[model samples]
Target: MSKTILYARVSTTDQTIDHQKDQAEAAGFVIDEVVADHGVSGISTELKEREEGKRLYDKLRHGDTLVVRWVDRLGRNYQDVTDTIRHFMRQGVVIKTVINGLTFDGSTKDPMQEAVRDALIAFMAASAQAQAEATKEAQRAGIEAARRDGSKYRGKKPSYDREALGVVVDMLGQDKGASEISKATGLTRQTVLRIRSDPAAADVTLSRWES
Candidate 1:
């Protein structure tokens, strides 16, 4: 029998995979298994490279189904997301998203059906990619504005382990963008921007926190 598997990822401590499962269950999907990756941002990492994502490849089989909250949950870029879906489709696996109830199957042979399916996949994948970029840009802008206003950072308090913070500083030295650093480190963009805006202050904050 084909299994319906759910894959969920939480980029930050503030998020939960349970929410993704809840959303899927509410949508009436009978999930046979759930694979979750914690403290990993889908926007920065490819699905196949993620820890739990690797498990997915081994578990999914022909005629099985993969369900997610959205295409962005699968990948952050157009090429990455579509390529993933196409691979599963070639395996005779169906991909479904709870948010849109999207169904992607490779069972169609008609010219028009094939064309429409490919077009929709391209459109959705592009939309997912664009949404990720827009969100990252907005986050960076908001952080920059907060820094300029000399106001406290907005949203949940930024927290990270010492090692992760060190990675942030190292990436900053390499002149990476705040959003990129945030995504790469799984740290909040606001925290990345704050550190980027004032390394001295960040040093003092780190010293105080360490003490």
Candidate 2:
């Protein structure tokens, strides 16, 4: 029988394996198994390079389902994400996301449906890469500003980290309410609202804290 497998890349201390599993369960996914890579950088490491991530190719079979918190967990960049998803779909594996509850499969023979699915995959992969790039840029900028201003001007540390900020941003993009995003991410409602009002500022704040 085909099983549902949850794949997670835990990049930060706050983003724990249990937290991801809980999020998936909360999202209503009945996971049969879980494969995760701790301290894995989704932006720097390809899924195939991860110790547990590599298991996905061997563990998954035809008709099995692959679940992730987001498409970003599959690859490092736009091309990698797109290629990975297409490869899995071609292998008759259905891919699903916990956040948006998106499903992609190769069962559809309709050309229009295929086209739409492919387009959406491309868009999501691109958006993931864009968000990664933006976060990196914000960190660089924040570090430079901190260096220029010195310790005396360093602002108060942010309550949330980069991972939390990303979650908030994703929810905000989906037009989710601050209270909802806060509850989902375990962040304060005020923090969610601050991120919604100005994501760049939120990013900078987190970056400054890191600096």
Best by lDDT: 2
Give candidate 2 misplaced runs (Cα > 4 Å).
152-211
Best-matching candidate per TM-score: 1
How well does candidate 2 score on lDDT at residue 184? Answer: 97
lDDT of 1 by residue, 85-193 (tens): 9999998999999997989998788999889989999999999888889999998998888778643543443376678878988998988899899899987888888
Badly placed stretches (over 4 Å) of model 1 are 151-211
lDDT of 2 at 42: 79
Report how far off residue 14 is in candidate 1 (Å). 4.9
Q: 148 in model 2: Cα distance from truth in Å?
A: 1.2
Worst 10 residues of 1 by lDDT: 149-158
